[model samples]
Target: MGSVELPGPPRAARPPRPARAPRPRRTIRRRALPYLLIAPTVLALAAVLGYPLVDLVVLSFQDMTRRELFSGATPPWAGLAHYRSILSDGFFWTVVGRTALFTVACVAATMVLSLLVALLMRRVSPWVRTVMTGVLVAVWAMPVMVAASIFRWLSDADYGVVNWLLGLLPGLDFSKHNWFENPWQGFAVITGVVVWGAVPFAALTLQAALSQVPAELEEAALVDGARPGQLFRHVTWPVIKPSAVLVTSLCAIWDFGVFNQIWLMRGGQPEKDYYLLGVYSFIESFAVNRYSAGAAIAVLTVLMLLGGAVVYVRQLVHLGAAE
Candidate 1:
């Protein structure tokens, strides 16, 4: 019985464990990879933007004028005098208000229109979708200058296509209408141009985001008697929210600093009424030769933008947590 107990079933062999890299080395590699990947971008941006920013800040502290600029003479330090002047100027506050309102209007219009277009693209047939995508891509590829030029021509004071089209309607006479005569009307036209150019990018991005929404979830919601709004609110919105946030912030920043559209529309000399932060800075620097003041304005503008970005990011964090 003792001898019979010696020949039991053979035990299964275990595979040998592979040797692991050291934990410190692996941890360091993992930690450094992201920074390494982003190093080139950081270098490129610093090379391009870093020097100019430093110079701007230095210039803001100096009483730089055209005389000193052309003569290559170092301007005397003016301390915070320029900033004090800008802060005290009522016109500066007005421009800030105008810029903010303009940005809000343009961003709102662009997002609404873009969302509608994205939804339209999603619901259409394949062929129609293809054609729509093609059109959007073409639009997105158009340069800002070209788009602004086209819009300017369309809303020209005389012999404009917009006026012609409006004239075609009975009891409406838009012929020879001067869109820029009224600041409100001019701003409306500029907002249209901005929205037109911004919509394609936003719509395309949203369309892509919409594709990530699970068809199964949407179907289940529909099956449960969810209304279209309810379905979108409960299912689609959560998926597209991040993309929407990105587009919105970018649009806000871009619109807030809009210069070329207004400048080009006004033939490189935007009137006081049409002056945004960008134009105001440029005019103060180049037009009025108040370089120090202009630099101060520019710095203030950047601070405002950064503040807004911080607020927006905080809001997004809170929203994400609440969801």
Candidate 2:
């Protein structure tokens, strides 16, 4: 009887709304599409840069030579022999010393030249500044080899234009000076060439940074009876400090890997006097065809660069913290 009460409209069990399948999860690759566009460039870098560097690291532990340049033939295992030789050899030490000296001289010269140029550019009329900028760009645009060749021709002891110019000076050494005869001479030549090539970029960078410095701040300092030296030391120098650091780090890095200058000029001659770390490794690899030794030297060079980068990064961190 109760059932017959006929579920007068058995409360319609509401059909559950069709449960929508959870939206398909977005894939990480889809999210990364923007960055994936850079894959071609990264792949190219992997081919030209990444593979060679990896090969170098692997080859260091193996006794690879010109005979096995690209062949799959296995190289003999010479665990650390090349590395030990590199570390103990007096020649490598000499290269290290020369490399340090070259970096210091070139960096210092480049900084000084760049800072002076920046100051001069700031003081000059806009047109003159523009002209100087054009000239610097021109010099920087010239290929290193072309510049080196020109300098080489001009560096010839007898017919060298530099020697001739020195003769015109009131007090100077006009005698035949072989630019590549010794380490210091070789370094000086390299330093000069590097500075000439590098100063423009530094100058431009500093000039741009200087332009951003508040003129009112400088004027305020001047009004406070600040001498030019004091103004520079207190106001200009602090404002430009970051730019200076950047320039120094960049020049240091550039000079560290400087191969063409040393290769064209010194070729690691005179008991490996002028041999820099970059040139030394290059000669080890290509010139002498000692892949293992070259790889070891290459590893050392990379370590040096990485060490320098670490120090530079630490400096940047400190600079940032200071700010």
Candidate 3:
């Protein structure tokens, strides 16, 4: 045993293992960084947007007259009184119907015009396309109020270019014709203005979408004896359907709440016969000093728009599933 122990070698020492740095602190910091970065934006939005919205909702539930507003008196709680008054009124329903009609007309016209413009752009030379795009951008950049004012001036019964142009036509005396005197004519004018303003944006969006369509697919369709309409229906349309839907939805939303052009052009005058929801809301809120009623109308308008948005989203989902 003593002789065997003498032949045994000593064990070598093991190296020390490196210690892992703590990860929990770093992980927490990394997670918190994004929230910290976005905190300012969230706070700003709450202050600017959230507060006004909350105030509007609160005001809607209170009977806040102009006198009360000025006298710093607390508005009495009206609960659903405002809503009931607005809903029970026949004029309110009429205004709502008019609003819906106007929105539908404007959206339809805008979509058609935009699609035409987009197709035209696709066929144009580069230089022509650039000039057309510039013109569209200029029109889109024009302020709503300014454009409305210009249209109002142009459609004026006296000293207007529209009347002068119409006078040039034989047996057509539009010099004394009042466009805004009639509800239908006023609606048409307002719809035209809105469509003109909206078409540029929709056209640009559609053009961009069209550009994404595979040229090879279009060429193949053409080679297969597909007519222009067939080629578009089968190839171009499917490719641009999403963008068209989006543009149309946006146009509908904007047209639904169109206030500036309508207000500037008509101002709910002529016995309020041509009144849309926006004009009616303004008249109820400011002109007549029924703030609560106006707020209720505004709320209802928002709900209607929300319903439209939901429908639009569902359509988008269905389209995606089809693909």
Candidate 4:
């Protein structure tokens, strides 16, 4: 019975289960994918902008003379000598004053004209708006060099339409008169060109901001015995204030460093009387071949603009917080 029972039960063997292959380890490329995607842009910026800035800083610290440049000799370290010379010069202070005055005038004029245009845009008929927009776009599309050249030709001492028109005035004798002979007049001309060139952009920005304002608010103000000026002051201004400030800051920055317009109009004429920071920088670098000095002027100009930008950004932050 025991032998029969042992034969009746036979053991069955089970096959072994297959092992799964280990998951592929995350490669270094997988971790750095985002940065890798932006690598080309970052490299291009570094090559174009970053390298030039570094070179400028280095050049500013060295006395890079024309001879050294030609001879391919290493420039000697000036060690802030250029900055000291720039600071000690009385003429530099005068140039700084002129630059400040020019910047202020141009920015003020641009803001005023642009604001007026923007205000007008809101009330104009559709056809008028189309025409106005076309004009603005055309003006904005005009090249800076082209605009400057046109202004130059128009204000020419001889064969200028502007001088011709002025000569028609009975008491005024501007016929073939050198408008650029007087420094103040030259500055005025340059300011006019800058303001004209800037208005289109400023107006467009402001109109866009104005469009965001609720129509009901304006109507409500008008219904409540508010005059046009009062409606703008109470209802419109509060909303557009940030945009206005931003435009002002941008205009100030652009006007402060304006070179082509001033240079093309009057290249540091009348004993450099109308020399702005931009003009001075160009004169020092190319005209006089004082590369380090020019670089110093450029650095200072950047600092000034940075200060303005900081103030503007702070004001915007405050406005946002208040809201």
- Root-mean-square deviation per candidate: 7.8, 9.5, 8.6, 11.9
Candidate 1 residue-wise lDDT at 175: 83
State TM-scores per candidate. 0.88, 0.82, 0.84, 0.83
Per-residue lDDT of model 4, residues 86-117, tens digit only: 99999999988888999999999999999999
Best by TM-score: 1
For lDDT, candidate 1 versus 4, the one ahead is 1
lDDT score, residue 145, model 3? 84
Flag the better candidate by lDDT, 1 or 3: 1
**lDDT of predicted model 2:** 0.83
Query: Model 1 segments beyond 4 Å from truth?
Result: 1-22, 311-323
Q: In model 4, which regions exceed 4 Å deviation?
A: 1-43, 267-271, 315-323
lDDT of 3 by residue, 1-323 (tens): 35454565878878788898777888899999999999999999999988877888889999998778889999999999888888899989988988898888999999999999999999999999999999999999999888888888888888788989989999988977888778788788888789879989999999999999999999999999999999999999989988898788888888888887876776435348767787788888888888988888988888898888997888788878977
- lDDT (tens digit, per residue) of candidate 2 on 247-310: 7887899888888876665433424566678777877777778868878987988998888788
Please report the candidate that would top lDDT against the real structure: 1
Our tally of clashes for model 4 stands at 0
Q: In candidate 2, which residue pairs clash?
A: none
Query: Which segments of candidate 3 are over 4 A away from where they belong?
Result: 1-42, 267-271, 312-323
Cα lDDT of candidate 1 equals 0.92
Against the true structure, candidate 4 reaches a TM-score of 0.83
Write down the lDDT of every candidate, Cα atoms only: 0.92, 0.83, 0.87, 0.87
lDDT of 3 at 45: 97
Window of ten residues with lowest summed lDDT in model 1: 1-10
